[model samples]
Target: MIIIAAVDDRNGMMFNHRRQSQDKVLREKILSLTAGKLLWMDHYSAKQFDGCTAPQLNIDDRFMWEAAPGEYCFVEDTSVAHFEKWAEQIILFKWNRKYPGDFCFDIDVQKPEWKLSHTEDFAGSSHEKITMEVYDHA
Candidate 1:
């Protein structure tokens, strides 16, 4: 499975049980990237995409275990590092700023087994700029 997420400069994912920030451009980018593909996300994350046209599978806590290979998954409230063994690739959007956050992303993309395959910067509707990084399992 492929994992997609957004993180702050400090690799923070959320604070106060909610996302630290959001960008309309980033949401559109994710939708474009996952078009014609199955996107699996938890029920909470699903709410973020309300009225979206993409095919989404809303699962409970078992999303990680239930996701299949060749699928794309969007995660926010969970630590995705544990899925490394099952993940074929990981796409990360760096918010390029810090915000109040209690939840942190646990994956260390610096690991030798994960290769940084690509990176690009783009402006977001809410953020001035954001960096997108793609890592593939080596």
Candidate 2:
């Protein structure tokens, strides 16, 4: 499966069961990236995309397990360490700043098994710059 998430510089994903931040451009980017594919996410994560109907969204609490190979999963408030082996690619949208977080991203992209495949920085509605990094498994 393709894992997509938003994080801070420190890899923080959520705080007290809530996401760290949200950006219009980041959400649009995610929608664009997962277009024409099933995008799996939980109910809480779906709230951000209340009015959109372009992407094929699959809502399930067990989204990590439900997502098929080559499918995209928007992870917000979950620990994804256990699902690492099934991930074919990881796309991270970075906030470029730190936020208070209790739940953080588990996998270390610096590890030898993951290769940094692509990166780009763009302006967002809430942030001056949001960086995107795509990693592929070796």
Instruction: Please provide TM-scores, in order, for all candidate models, with all chains considered together.
Output: 0.93, 0.97
At residue 53, candidate 1 shows an lDDT of 67
The local distance difference test score of each candidate is: 0.86, 0.92
Point out where model 2 deviates above 4 Å.
Answer: none
Worst 10 residues of 2 by lDDT: 50-59
Best by lDDT: 2
Look at candidate 2 and give me any clashing residue pairs. none
Give candidate 2's TM-score. 0.97
lDDT of 2 at 32: 88
Put down candidate 2 lDDT per residue, 33-61, tens digits, no spaces: 88899999999999999998864888899
